[model samples]
Target: MVGVSKRVEAPSQGNREFTMTYANFAHIRDIAYDLTGITLSDHKQNMIYGRLARRLRALGLSSFDDYCNLLSEDSPELHEFINAITTNLTAFFRENHHFDFLKTTAFPNIIRKNMASKRLRIWSAGCSTGEEPYSIAMTLSATAGFSQWNAKILATDLDSNVVDKGRRGIYQEDRCTGIPNEYTRYLKRNPSTGEIKIREDVQEKIAFKQLNLLHQWPMKGPFDIIFCRNVVIYFDQETQKKLFARYHKMLAEGGYLFIGHSENLNRVSNDFTSLGKTMYQKK
Candidate 1:
């Protein structure tokens, strides 16, 4: 009699195929804009999902929804989420031509005009780790009697983790591959870690900070040269335009802005005049 009643299976909500929901994408997009002033387009949904999925697993959360709820709970977690998602790939003398332009043209001109002051201010915006600023320091150090002059470099990045690493001035030998042999000679190898670390002399000349470019900058600068290369590609057109305008305001008259090989400021911001091939001068 008990078997006479037919058993009915309740409708299974079986294995919900994971997809990046609009709500989830919007949450990530807002965080990016709030932290870095970079707007994530709808096309970057997959990127957001890929970058943040690990956070979910780490926290033992089974869903993106739960992970986001955790992020909202504390400022530290929010920072971790932002740092995880921001791209910070950079290398020393990444585009050789820009440095060549600096060595052959810009440096000579600046030194001549400011001989009395013998002062130079360079800012490496979006400087991931320490390569670019260290390269600039090496270049200045190589110039005869540069130590006698008032020369300094300021390097900043959005990720606090990378900024801390940059401040430490340590690097693996493999990452220093493209670094010139002369510069390598200046680096000291730690016996314990077998890691190459920038000498204190070179490191002392540069300062590193965690800066979110989209936010109000703390330092007022009439910087002689600003290297913000390869950073704007992640931003939308509007964000790029606004950022360039801000950069123009920060530059000293006749100062230069070096952008990525793929970037152009021609139509975006009229505050700068094209100086040819990824170089622009503030008007």
Candidate 2:
């Protein structure tokens, strides 16, 4: 029902190993929308085929219809299906401006505003691997007085694989190259192994969990800041509306919302006032 961009005839079966009929693609898109609020456009058919084909091969399923049937039965492969479809491209300090904004504005404002409570809560929704939340943790650790404050970050993703990876806090050495020199103190590098790990103290500041944005959230939050960057771009306008409304309810007074560079709240929801560079403050 959701993300039905268009209907087109299935492509010619030239040299392809498996068949992905239009009906099969349609069913998969519907399932994806229901499960993750992602709008899979027609252009993504090849990508979807490429990703899910591995599952088909692994399960020894011969065709998309068979795979669809397995999914229809709510097979355990559903998790793998979601994981395959979701994108996890990320980097340390991927959007440097957001961190800069935090260091210069949000953190100071929150520090002044919540001096009595000395509490800070941040959520990194759709945190791919550990980079985004680790970046947040590094930023917080670099802040002068936050060490004594009750600061915690919640990092969550729909993909269980990435969630587990994030929880481990280990990454390839090159994956951390973009981390600022000043914030590098929070990381440790294994010289021989070429692996980088977030220090235990910094790692302790975050809690990683596998979560679906479309599902019920377990934690009751009036979070001070939420970094849901590059996430809502997948959802349709209606889905975005509901999501932002929920975010408005979850945020503390004057809480900040940081979105992706390519994402905009315009024509989606007016619950937050845009602060430029994809940053927003709850109205």
In order of appearance, the predictions have TM-scores of 0.87, 0.97
For candidate 2, lDDT tens digit of each residue in 63-179? 998999999656798899999999998999998999999999999999999999999999999998989999999888888777679999999999999999999999998898999
What's every prediction's RMSD, in angstroms?
9.5, 1.3
- Rate residue 154 of model 1 by lDDT: 94
* Model 2 stretches with alpha carbons more than 4 Å out: none
What 10-residue stretch in candidate 2 is worst by lDDT? 1-10
Superposed by TM-score, candidate 1 places the C-alpha of residue 27 at a distance from the truth, in angstroms, of 2.1
Q: How many clashes in each candidate?
A: 0, 0
Q: After superposition, which runs of candidate 1 have C-alpha atoms over 4 Å from their true positions?
A: 1-19
Each model's lDDT comes to 0.80, 0.92
